[model samples]
Structures are given as C-alpha cells and as structure tokens.
Target: MKIEEVRQHVTTPLTAPAFAPVVPRFTDREYLNIVYRTDADALRAVVPEPLQVEEPLVRFEVMKMGDVSGYGPYTESGQAIEVSFDGERGEYLHAMYLDNFPATASGREVSAYPKTAGSPKLYVDNGVLVGTLDYGTLRVATATMGYKHHALDVREAERQITVPTFMLKTIPGYDGAPRVQELVRTEITDVVVKEAYTAPARLQLFQHVLAPLADLPVLEVVSASHIRTDLTLAPVKPVFDYLKGVRS
Candidate 1:
C-alpha cells in the first residue's frame, strides 16, 4: 500500500487510529446513572490540577449500546467525577470497563478514554434496573434502581449528558517516557432524548486489585435515572497539553 493509503486506514494491524477517522454513533442507548456524594478530600486527591472539584460528587454509569453506527453492540460501565475546567462545569472520566475489543481499542486510541477489558452487564430483572461490572472473576461494581418511577425533563437530561467531558490522555515515548500527555475534551451533540425517568437507586463498589472503585467510597446516593437517547459523539479536542503548555 502507498503511504497515502496507509494513512487513510482507520485501524492498524495492532492499534486503532485517532478519533476523527472512525465516527461512532449510538441509537436507543439505555443508561442507568447513579449519582453519589463522597468525601471532598478524597476527590481532590485523584482529580488533576486545572480541573476544579466544586462538589465531592461522582456519577457511576452503566450503559447498553444497542445499535452502534461503526462499532458493534457493547455494554459499558464507568465512573465520572463532577468537575470544572476553566470555570466550565464538566465531568472527568476516571475509568471505563467494556466487554468489546473493537470498542475498547477505538475508545482508548481515538478519544483517550481509559478503557480496559471487562464484562459489564445492564438489564432489567423483575422490574428492577440492574447493572453490574466484573473484572475477570471478581465483581467490582453493582447498581440497582427502581424502573421509571417518574418522568424527567428531556431538555434537562440532554444538558446533563451533553456537557463537556474531560479525559487524561497519555502515550508512551520510545524511551518509555511520556510522549503525548494532554487533557482531552469531548461532548455529545444532536441528542434526541426518547425517554427519561428517575427513581430511587443504590450503588456499591467493592474493593478489588484490578478495579479499585471503592477507593472513592460512596457516602450517599444522591439520585438515579434511566435515560434512552440517540446521539453522535463530537470529535475530541485537546483542551490542555500538559507537557507543552498549549491550549487548543
């Protein structure tokens, strides 16, 4: 293949290309997000500088992507902390565990999402919305919420999901040092909220070596919601380059 042809390929033999090449869209995405308040000091310890933690809050999400445009169907579970970047309120994605390999590769390479191989299941059981995440044989997180207790405003739901999301992207250099280290920002646009509901919820994060979600420790369950939506992920843009001190 010519150099131009090689550059056009989205997926390499072993690595996935950047975000712009592969556009992923999701339809009828079922999400169950559990919001919790934790210790303020603990949150400040992990959240990076330049991103301010206004409240000690975290959103644990369990989602089932039914129809993905480019990648196939997959289930995902992750944790995002409420933070502010340059006076703009947003969420910083801490970690994600997914079952599909292609989605994992693209999510990490393209968007700098901290994705790893794991099993995440989100389903309804006997009228209860249930979500679970397991790393290998150990269960890391489990959440349950009442199914559709009350309706939620579609516009407010859209705003919650469409806000800017921050990520710490890193690539190793040839000498094993940091090559590309920057703060990536991304958001979902053209969101069509089909249905939204809220109900009482509970979350538990177990302590494990691989997925140490308990490090954050859920202090109180603030709220829970189930949302069905369709949206296209906007292209990733770097907001801060840690090594170069450049802003995009």
Candidate 2:
C-alpha cells in the first residue's frame, strides 16, 4: 500500500506515512514507577508545557492473512506487543516542571510514557547494514541465524530448515523481580519460502541496551497457519490513557 493510504485513517502521533491499518487497531498501557532522585535547582532549570490530565488514547491493530480455496483446514499465527512509550515521560516531565512547578519545587512524581520498537528491512552484508524488501509490515523480522550450536552467515541462513526462535524470559520462578534472559530454542515446520529478502536495519535497533533481554535468541518457527481472530468488546480505556497523566 502507498504510504499516504496507510496513514490516512490513523491519528496516532507515532505513525509515519508508510503503513496504515487493515483492521481496528488496539493499544495497551500500564504505569511503571522509576525510582530516582531529582534536584530542586535542577528541576527549576527546566520548565514545561501546561499539564492536561486527559489526552486521546489509541491503539493500532495490524494482521496478515491468506486463504487457499482448495484447502481443507487453515493455518495461521497471531502475536501482539504492548504499544507503549518511554520518551513521552521525558517530554512530559520537562514540560510540567518548567511550567507548573510550585515556587519551592522539591521533588518529582512517579512517571512513565509510551515505548515502541519497530522492525525495518535489514541484513548485514560485509559487516555493514544494508536494506532489503519490507517484510509484511513487521517492525522486526525473525531471520534464521546460527543453527544448532553453529553460527552461520546471513546468506547461509535459509539452507537450514530447522531454525530457532529467540525469546527473552523473566526468570521463570522469580517474583515480580527484574531479570531477563535471551535464549534460542525452536525448529521450523512445513513451509514455503515465497519471499526472501535480507533486512539490514535490525542491526541498529538491536543494541547493548537490549543485550540483557532476548537479542537474536533462536526460536523454533514452524509454517504457521493463518490467524483465527477472536473478537470481543474493547474496554472503555486502555493502557495509554492512564499513562498520559503520569508525571514524568
């Protein structure tokens, strides 16, 4: 789809002109407290926009599907990540303190904002990132990398049918504690390689910051069947709504 067509129906601030929704989009949000210390003089140094307790909240929905007329049974897979923010908190904090702080601004309030990650076409050639075909609107594409204890080059990836899906997990038994691990575990299933393009942009987003989380950890990806959507009434307010008011 043309970029403008994709963005026409979207009012989301984070949207670009490239892609648009094929279905009703959804967003989920939650507040996370970041413990820190703020200086009286430091906060005074920066001012902010007038605070508005209410702001429009929106979530984006996207799905891909295909059907074979002669087929007996259908197959598909669906996955959705929480649409959120981190930068909004920073911006909101900057605005409010500068514009709304009391004469003796002494401290800070718990704050949070939207955090989103996208996948762009990417693959590394000669150790340099290079562009490739866009893969089905996916912000990130899962590429078959090293196999069964063997690290393979990007070119040699398709040769291995059995691939791993990487996953970042919270220490399974640990309480709401903070810890994450990346591990490669999975093999491919009955499949079709109709489109193949090496995506290079992934290199930039996968940084040292996410090293503690799942980085190219392998996943056992089978030929997934077409997704079967389960529809239900959405809630009055999703996550981002509450986030808009959080003091950053």
Candidate 3:
C-alpha cells in the first residue's frame, strides 16, 4: 500500500479493521443506574487533579445495548464518580467493563475510554431488575432493584444521563515514556427517553484483585433509576493536556 493509503487506514490491523467508521447510535438502550455514597478519601485517591469531588458519590451503571449502529447487542457495567471541573459539575469515568471486543477496542483506541473486557449482564429475572458483573467466572458486583415501581420524570432522567463525562487518556511512547496524557470530556446528546422509573435498590460489590470496585464501599444508596432511551454519544474533546503543560 502507498504511504497515503497507510495513513488513511491505520486504525487497528493494517489489513482489516474490527469496526466500521460510523458514529455509534443506540436504539432502546436501557440503563440501571444506582447512585450511592462512598468514602470521600477513596474518591480523592482515584479522581485526578483539577477535578474536585464535592460529594462522595458514585454511579454504578449497567447498560443494555439493544441495537447499535456498528456493534450488536451487548451489556456494559461500570462506575462514575461525581466530580466538578472548573466550576462545572460532571462525572469522572472510573472504570468500564463489557463483553464486546470491537466496542471495547474502539472505545479504548479511538475515544480513550477506560474500558476492559469482562462479562456483564443486565436482565429482568422474575419481576426484579438484576445486573451482575463477573470476571473470569467470579462474581464481582451485583445489583438488584424493583422493576419500574414508580414512574420517574423523563426530563430528570435525561438530565442525569446527559451530564458531562470526563476521562483521563494516557498513552506511553515506544521507549516507555509518557507520550500522550490529557483530560477528555464528552456528553450523550440526541436522546429520546422512552421510559423512566424509580425503584428501591441495593448494591453489593465484592473484593476482586482485578476489578476493585469494592474499594469504594457503598455507604448509602442515594437513588436508583431505570431508564430506556435512544441516544448517540458525542465525540470527545480534550480539556487539559498534562504533558503539554509540563513541556512548557
């Protein structure tokens, strides 16, 4: 291939790419979000600087992707910590685990998402909404909630999911030195909330050497929401470049 062709198709494998060049759009994406209070010190230790943690809150989410543009149906589970940047309220993505290889590759390579490969399932068992995450056949996290017990305001659900999300992107050079390090932010826009509800919920996180979600022990279950929507994720933009600042 010519140099120009190589430059244009340098995504993953030089011969074949896993996913197409298309913006991800989800249809009937369901979310089970449980916002709980955790230890403030734990939040401080994980959350990066320039981001302040006002409340010791973490949102544990299990997402069921019904239909996506490029990738097919998959389930994802992760945690986001409540944080603020430059006086703007947002959530910092701590970790994400899913089962899809293409989605995981694109998330980490293209968007710099903190994604890892794991087994996560979100389904309705009997009349209860159940979400579980396991690593290598070992259960790490489990959450249960009443299935649509009370109706929730659609606007509130939209607001909750549309909050600005921040993530740290880091890449090392061939010599094992820091090459790219920055803080990026993104939001989910173009959403149509199909259903939203509230329910009594409980979370249980087990101690895992790999998936250390239990590091932030659940102090109190502040709120839980069951929402279904069709949305598209916006492209991420870098807000702070740590390496660039250090070079100057």
Candidate 4:
C-alpha cells in the first residue's frame, strides 16, 4: 500500500487486527447487573486517586450483545465500583473479561479498557437469567437473577446509563516497565432503553490466581437489574495523567 493509503487505515499497520478499523457499537444488549456491598478498605486500596468511593458498593455486570456494528456478537462480564470524580457520581470499571479476541484487542488498544480473553456466557435457563465467566476449565464467577421481575423506570435507567465511566489504562514500555498510564473516562450517548427490569439475584466469585473476582468479597447482596438497551460506545478521554507526576 502507498503511504497515502496507509494514513487512512484505522488500526496500526503490520499488527494483527481482530475487529474492523472503526469502533463497534452494540444494539439490544441484554444486561444483568448485580450490586453488592463490599469491604471499604479493599475498595479504597484499589481505586485510583481523583476518584472517590461513593459507597462500599460494587456492581458486577454480565452483558450479552445481540448485534454489533462491526463485530458480530459477544458476551462480557466485569466489575465496577460506585465512585465519584469531581463530585460527579459514576462507575469506575475495575476489570472485564470476554470471549471475543477482536473485541478484546480493540478495546484494550483503542479505548484502554482492561479487556482480557476468557469464556463468558449469559443465557436464560428455565425461567432464570444466568451469567458465568470461566478461565479455561475453571469457573471464576457466576450470577443469576430473576427474569424480568419488575419493570424498570425508563427515565431513571437512562440517566444511570449516561453516567461517566472511569478506567485505568496502562501500556507497558519496551523494557516491560510502565509506559502509558492514564485515568480514562468514557460516556455513552444516544441511549435508547427498550426494556428494563428489577429482580432478585445471587452471585458467587471463586478464588483464582489469574481471575481474582473474590478480592472484593460480596459482603451483602443489594439489588439486581436486567436491561435491554441500544447505545454507542463513545470515544475515551483521559482525565488524569498518571505519568506526569513521575520524577524524571
């Protein structure tokens, strides 16, 4: 390809590109979010600076994307904590695991999302909605919730979905040292909530060396929600530069 043609490419040249050059958007996403209380100290230790903990609560989410703009479909599971940045309450995404390689690679390289490859499944069995994440043959986390127990308020759900999301984006240097480290923020726009519901739920996180979901122990089950929404994943912005404070 000519140099002028290379400039039009979306992803890095000569690298293995999984998804398309553009960012993928999801539609009619089935979501199961389980909110729970956890130890305040453990949360304080992991949560980065500039983002304060709103409460000792965390939300574990298992999402099944029905259709995507670029990539086809995938299932993802992760944890986010209730946090505030500059007095604005939002979620700080801790970690995420998905089965799609292209989605994982693009998410990490483009948006700085902490995406790793794993087996994550969300499905309805009998009358209950079940979500599970596994590393190889070992199950790491599992969650279940009642299927559409009560209708969710559309306005409130839309407001909650638009909240700012923070993530720790890190890329190692050539020598395996810290290279790029930033506190990235993302917000979803053009949200259209088709259906939502509140329900009873249960969660179980097993101890594992690689997947440590149990690090933030589930102290108490708070609430659960199942939602179907269509939204676009907006571009990420860095709110805090972690490397700026390093002494040269």
> Who wins the lDDT comparison?
3
Rank candidates by TM-score, best first.
3, 1, 4, 2
Candidate 2 on 1-248: residue-level lDDT in tens?
58876555433333441222232221110101111223323332322222121211111111222332122112111121111133222112121111112111211111111112322232334544232212234222222221122223423333322222211222333575434222212223334333222221121112234221123221222211111122211211112221243322
Candidate 2, run of 10 with poorest lDDT: 26-35
Can you tell me which runs of candidate 2 are displaced by over 4 Å? Answer: 1-116, 119-157, 166-168, 171-175, 178-184, 195-248
Tens-place lDDT per residue, model 3, 1-248, is: 89988888637688889767789999999999999999999999999988899999999999999999999999999999999988999999999999999899889878978999899999999989999999889999999999999999999999999999999989899999989898999999999999999999999999999999999999999999999999999999999889876311
Which portions of model 3 show Cα errors greater than 4 Å?
A: 246-248
Q: Put down candidate 1 lDDT per residue, 62-136, tens digits, no spaces.
A: 989988976768899999999999899999999899988778888887778899988999999988999999999
**Could you tell me every candidate's TM-score relative to the true structure?**
0.95, 0.20, 0.97, 0.93
The parts of candidate 4 lying over 4 Å away from their true place are 1-4, 10-16, 246-248
What TM-score does prediction 2 earn? 0.20
Off by over 4 Å in 1: 14-21
Evaluate residue 31 in candidate 3 and report its C-alpha lDDT on the 0 to 100 scale: 98
Top candidate when judged by TM-score against the true structure: 3
In model 4, residue pairs whose N, Cα or C atoms come closer than 3 Å (at least 3 residues apart or on different chains), thus clashing, are: none
Candidate 4 displacement at residue 22 in angstroms: 1.5
The true-versus-predicted C-alpha distance at residue 224 of model 1, in Å, is 0.7
